[model samples]
Target: MSTNFCETATRVLDIEAKAITGLKTYINQDFNDACQLFFNTRGRVIVSGMGKSGHIGNKIAATLASTGTPAFFVHPGEASHGDLGMITQSDVVLALSNSGETEEILKLLPVLKRLGIAIIAMTGNPDSTLAKLADIHLCARVEQEACPLGLAPTASTTAALALGDAIAVALLEARGFSADDFALSHPGGSLGRRLLLRISDVMHDGSQIPLVDEQATISAALLEISRKGLGMTGVLNAQGQLAGIFTDGDLRRILDQRIDIHQTLIVSVMTRNCVTIRAEMLAAEALKIMEQKKINALMVVNAEKVPVGALNMHDLLRAGVL
Candidate 1:
């Protein structure tokens, strides 16, 4: 009577995987019609479902909304109450019900039709009432459920979820959705921080910037770097333009040569023609440059190469772009 749990789990995964693969054949003209319906709609894509289908519907709606096809979910039961008001004639309906005969969902069909809202149906039974009533039926039919007793919504729900993801991705491509657009929809997440943040938003600027005159001694640059805590100092010429840069790494290199930090001028040892970035450039771009060039810090400048700000790996880490 001992149950082999691992064996059962593996079998369940295989069954679910096969069920999702079966959805490939169903992606025919009906799939295209569904995508077109979602893409052409000026208003939101309203998704509704019952039971387990409702959970999948919520995720599907979220995916569509984040991927540039504005959508939201309304429980079929709630839609029968007052949530139906959330949907308008301009919006399209995506209804999910594996059996295609859910009473709650079927109840809304007449009202949605009277309003002239197109319905895209996802169900296991293509011949069921919901499928027949829908303007476009996306058959999510599967050979069997992964449940040992052949009752629970296992493989069937997995197949439905995969099909929903496929439609969302197809619509995303058709809508020309980009990563930046996705970031805008997810501003509170790390991806948003990485994509939307600019160098100016995080860099040390004004008096926070470590700066020294080109004629300043190495000791002066070290003091500026220490006081500013940026590990580097921008050396400016008499014309008030960036002449070079001196860093702690430069100090280490010059230290071995026994160059007197108090007497040696910064211009002689500072790195000239150094890498610089614009304040307007994305902070992610700055991270790319730092990784590619094997550097820890960057100077943010303007069109004239005047040092406007400075940032390091620490700044990016704090901003969650790392």
Candidate 2:
């Protein structure tokens, strides 16, 4: 029984895969026209459909909205009651129906026409009324349903969804949508935290910064590093500018050379002109610099190159950037 079940599942996957592959033939002038219309629209793309098609439409609208194209899904059954008012003349309608003759969707056509809203229809039947009425018609035709009984909308819906993704991606590329732009739409996600989190947001600032004068002895710098627990400290010159940095690694080297911590000036033993990042730079950018420099800590500097803040890898890990 298990073997039979596995075979059935594999058959379903094969049929759906073929259905998605067959959609490539329909990526012609009609698809291009549909994308052009969607891209040029100043208002939102209003997506509508019935039943399973409605579910697919909702996801497509979300993908479009998140990827630089503004869109929303309005159920056709609800649109016939009162939701039709949500669509405006400036908005473009993207209607989905496998047979291209869904009654609830058909009921909205006259009202949509009177409003002068452009319609783009995605259907398996090109000769159907919905396709005939649309300004652009995309053929999502598939040979057969993945369902063994040929009763459920399986392969057809998968084809329609893939086609929707293709359109969304094409529009995303045409608009030059970037990862930072995507992060703005999803600020609550991990990618947003990585891209939008500035060094100022995560770095130790003001009194929390581990800093010592360049003229201070290595013992004083070590005391600051111990107090701050950042495993490092910044050595500033008499002019209040960043002169050098002293880290745990630097301490290891100094100890190897038997330099007396009480007698050596920090400027004489510290790393001169260490790598620094801007306060406004992203924390992810800081992580890249730390990895490249083979260091665990960095000093955040201002436009004038004065050390303003400090952070270590632990801060990044705690902030969910790592």
lDDT of 2 by residue, 132-236 (tens): 999999999999999978989999999999999999999999999987898889898677889789999999999988999999999999999999999999988
**In model 2, which regions exceed 4 Å deviation?**
4-22, 143-146, 176-184, 187-196, 214-217, 237-239, 250-273, 287-295, 320-322
Candidate 1 per-residue C-alpha lDDT over 1-322 given as tens digits, one digit per residue, 9 for 90 to 100? 9999999999999999999998989989999888988888989999999999999999999998999999999998988899999999999999999999999999999999999999999999999999999999999999999997889999999999999999999988987898778878988878889989999999999999989999999898899999999789899999888888888888888878988889999999999998999998889999999999998888888888789999999999999999
- For each candidate, the alpha-carbon lDDT, in order, equals 0.92, 0.94
TM-scores, each model vs. reference: 0.84, 0.82
Model 1 segments more than 4 A misplaced: 1-9, 178-180, 189-192, 237-240, 253-273, 291-293, 320-322
Q: What is the lDDT of residue 16 in candidate 2?
A: 96
Determine the backbone clash count of candidate 2: 0
Could you give me the TM-score of model 1 versus the true structure?
Answer: 0.84
**Residue 288 shift from truth in candidate 2, angstroms:** 4.8
Model 2 per-residue lDDT at 276: 95
